[model samples]
Target: MATFTKANADYLRNTLQEAVVKCSERCLYQSAKWAAELSVSLPTLPSVSSSFDADTDSQMQDVDPPPISPAFHFANNDPEEARLEAQDLSRYLLAKSYFDCREYDRCAAVFIPSALPRGPLSPTSPNSNRRTPTKAGKGKGKDSGVITEVGSEPPSNALPKLSQRALFLALYSKYMSGEKRKDEESEMILGPADGGSTVNKELVGITRSLEGWFADREARGLSGSNQGWLEYLYGIVLAKGKTEEDAKRWFIRSVHLFPFNWGAWLELSELLNNVEELQKVVPELPQNLMTLIFHLYASQELYQSTDPIHKELDELENIFPDSQFLKTQRALLYYHSKDFDEAETIFSALLHADPHRIDSLDFYSNILYVMSARPKLAFLAQVATATDKFRPETCCVVGNYYSLKSEHEKAVVYFRRALTLDRNFLSAWTLMGHEYVEMKNTHAAIESYRRAVDVNRKDYRAWYGLGQTYEVLEMHLYALFYYQRAASLRPYDPKMWQAVGSCYDKVDRPVQSIKTYKRALVAGTYYDQGSSFGSGTTAGEPTGVLDPETLYQIALMYEKLNQLDDAASYMEMTLAQEEGPEEDDDDEAGGHGIGVTTTTSKARMWLARWEFRRGAHVRAMELANELCQDGVEVEEAKALIRDMRARMESGRSPS
Candidate 1:
């Protein structure tokens, strides 16, 4: 266990791989490969290395781990190409293992730029660990091996000059290590309570260094080798910072130079914040397969309607028919639409086909949670946690399961753990806010909601949660802003519109309230009918189920503005939708669910009053009598009856 060498690393790797196969643990293989790469003894724990010759490097280069066929997700790649990729993957097994282990510092160290070790170097050379290049005359090259850089230049002539994968890994590992180190420092300085910043201050330092590195390379007439990847990483640093236009430029450069890189396309897609931005950026994107896929993903995220996007996805499937990525995209599109049933079906198939896949199971859990399928969600949580307990997604699934059980405290713990694992976990922050709200910890909920929005402003739930917390505190003005933001993000969501309408009413802006309520009615009917039609009409012509409270509010607003005829008409519409009498304490209030005291009796009472005002004494009397019998709005009903009776007796009514 103390001293390590090529043989010791090989032995340990075989042992670990055996366990991986036996347990069917895919992540374990990654762990084992990384472990073996770092198998050389550390001075603190292991004995010194023995003198090894250059032949070891060539022998190790020839040997590769057993090939694992890339899944159908990469079916787009040719078989020959896939084989080459497998070999390329094994080239840096040691560093890859460290990355999988989350040892970013160690991972970066393995790929740091250094002078190439040519056929020979001085014995006193700084890199004594590097092997002397063996000549063909040396027969011992077959048996004697030595450690070298995991991700140096290309392992084969066919690959890119700089080993782009290794270079990106090296740079990204350093980037992530900087983030980790900064977080540690921040925790020390600001304490955990104020830690987990979304600012990412360390990125600035890396970005500056990358700028200098690129300039030096250009000045020295270096080959473009990893130009695209370097640009992609640079774009990442800029994207995370506020240099919006600069980020876009580099992402474009990255995509143009390396059209096959999915990350470049994805980062560009995320940079587009709105449908307008998306459409504008789409034209700028080079017309390629990657752009087409990015277009589908971006469309799913923006424009709320997925009907057209489904057609687009179907078209893409024609090209990549067996692609699991496309299938998951379709599933994700459904999930975004809140069409849980369809989402559930597709996700279930995807999971069944590849149980070890970890991309979107947290999303599957969310769909189940929304559907109140507790047992299914619980099973998903268990499976996700078992697959990779350290993953942020797994923690989110566990958190959701606990949340469903009404275990708010446990839910918060898991969500916080998810945040600890990945501070940028959008779902964890939003869900944690929900848990805090359930616990009535408004301050904590506010912090979580803010952090969620800071990570990704597109998450409407976080905006809505902030509104809910403010509304609970009777901070109507603040609630109005957040609700409006949420509504703007999810314009078709009835609940968001209703919340906005409710806020307007609370602030006594009846005109605005009436307008918003109408929109809510349209959105509700539009969503319920699964319409592929355009954004619902603002007039809110209900084609299906209607919110009677919204109707009642419209009447109340009309009444307040002295539009008596309009008031009576809306009040009658409200009465048509009412199922039974309600015991209302107030006379003119509409009991909408968002922010009102509502009772069925109030609608009846208001209708009766409106009828009496129009000189319909007999109609008013009948409605008032019913309200009195129902014991709701009794006082208002009695007064209406007496007024009608007196007016009738005076021969000024019921003619």
Candidate 2:
């Protein structure tokens, strides 16, 4: 008989119950090991049988006799009952063995007998049926299933389905089990066992049922009819498999099936960056649908697929003509497109409609500076300037407007004010550094850029500004490092490469300068192609503007070595691109460059001189006459044209 106090008995019983619920092969094996240990420690009863003679001086009478129960009696005298009990225990042992080996099928097969015990009176029991087979020859294999078949119904449908809550309990029971698996030898040993803990069996059962239900549901979902659902499912699976192309295909399919769903469209747009896909789907979508989807997608750090974003403004214009959101989008796009006039018009309209539209004012000011419209930039800066208070970013934007307008002192004031509001504002620090750079304050600029980098090391503009400051201070190597860092972040920026090439030129490496210039041209081609002005800049189409200054340098190389005619032709071609103001007061001054304060008659006179030297008398005369008629300080132009024409008229040209 086992000795037990109230606490000890409760603890042992609770521990045993917990072990049974775990049912893992490892847990079962561990429990059997514990049972084996306890078996050796059990007190064996003296086998005197029913013939207890007086000569047998046993202490059972002297000491308190233990209570006898049917359980103890079955273990002692009944050989047949003992044999049956032994068979019942064999199922648990076999189940544990199968489970430890990860033979789920076999483990489940042996687990049935342990769950459904059999006795002589039990007709539905496997062992009972085995004792007496009906004429139908039932119960052929007792240990071959998770449970005996319930009247030929499918296994899934036949089993009682558990709910999610019940499944959770089952998982928790497995997690809390004190036993360690063979594979988990590195885990810590459990402190002690508890037996009397009554786990909520109902919860566990419900959980198991729910797990089975979800598994069935998932299986059915695999053959789902909805294309969107199927695509989403396949996308997740393919993504897990690391097949990005297959994942992309499914993502696109999901968008095709459900264009209106924001989540689906965004997810597909992110993975499948095919601009043609967006272009095809955008027009078919309802108004504002694309906007909602893209706003969510733009949250990623790397800004991929700019085509959809660039087209969003056009779509918004068609949909919400007078909407504030549409107006802002158009303003931003126009600013990027360098259509400052249109951007100004839109932003002005927004301000007229609502004076408190701060974003319109800020973007309007930025476009004004970028377009070199100084007067308008000043006006808009004043418009956004606040008497009460402003956000740090807004103040930084205002400071930049002033800085671009060459008002460094005023820019510094606003930049300082912005830093006061938000000390960690990286853009403000960057703008302030640029202002310092303009003011030729290299130390101040360096310190400002340092503060900017402290706030945000990834800010390419700040790094570029810092590099520019170093370049100005004649620190070529330091400038190179900072410029390289900035270029890595924004490799598409041609200006950055040009700056890098200039640094090389500063260091007396002309060949390296030439190489870097070529690299810049390549980047410029790519950047311009993707830019709003791509078609004209990259496709050999004319934009009525001179070739870039870097290209002009190459043209200069052609100018050297007495290529006077070629130089004059290129210079004239460059000059021809300079359009006069459309609202000119007089045609006599019609050819003056628009927006230029200085007269370009000097360049015109030089071309005329070049023509005279080349012996193109008639062309020289024509240019000379135009320059002389304008009274633009062209000395002896008439005399030169007359002399050149006279020489050409003669058989020999003038030397």
Q: Using Cα atoms with residue i matched to residue i, what is each candidate's TM-score against the true structure?
A: 0.70, 0.40
Q: Write the per-residue lDDT of candidate 1 for residues 209-242, one digit (tens) a residue.
A: 4544554444444434433767778788767655
For candidate 2, lDDT tens digit of each residue in 1-655? Answer: 2222233323323333332333232343433333332222322333212221212211112233344332322121334424543554555566555555655435544432222111122234321221110122346422122122335322242233322212222232232221222113222111122111222222222222322333354445421323243344335333423344545555555545433333444344544333344455444333333334354233121223256554544443332234565556656554544455677788878777766546435456555555566676666566666522476646765776767757899989888877766555665777778777778888878888887876565566778888888888889989988987776655655666777777776776656665666676676654332222111121222232332454443334345434555556545654454463333566444433332112345456666767777766667777778777767655666776667667777867667
Specify the poorest-scoring 10-residue window by lDDT in model 1. 140-149
Q: What is the C-alpha RMSD of each candidate to the true structure, in Å?
A: 16.5, 28.8
Please give the CA lDDT of all the candidate structures.
Answer: 0.64, 0.48
How far out, in Å, is residue 187 in model 2?
A: 50
In model 1, state the lDDT of residue 187: 52
Give the number of the best model, judged by TM-score: 1
Off by over 4 Å in 1: 1-101, 110-167, 186-202, 217-227, 529-543, 578-601, 625-655
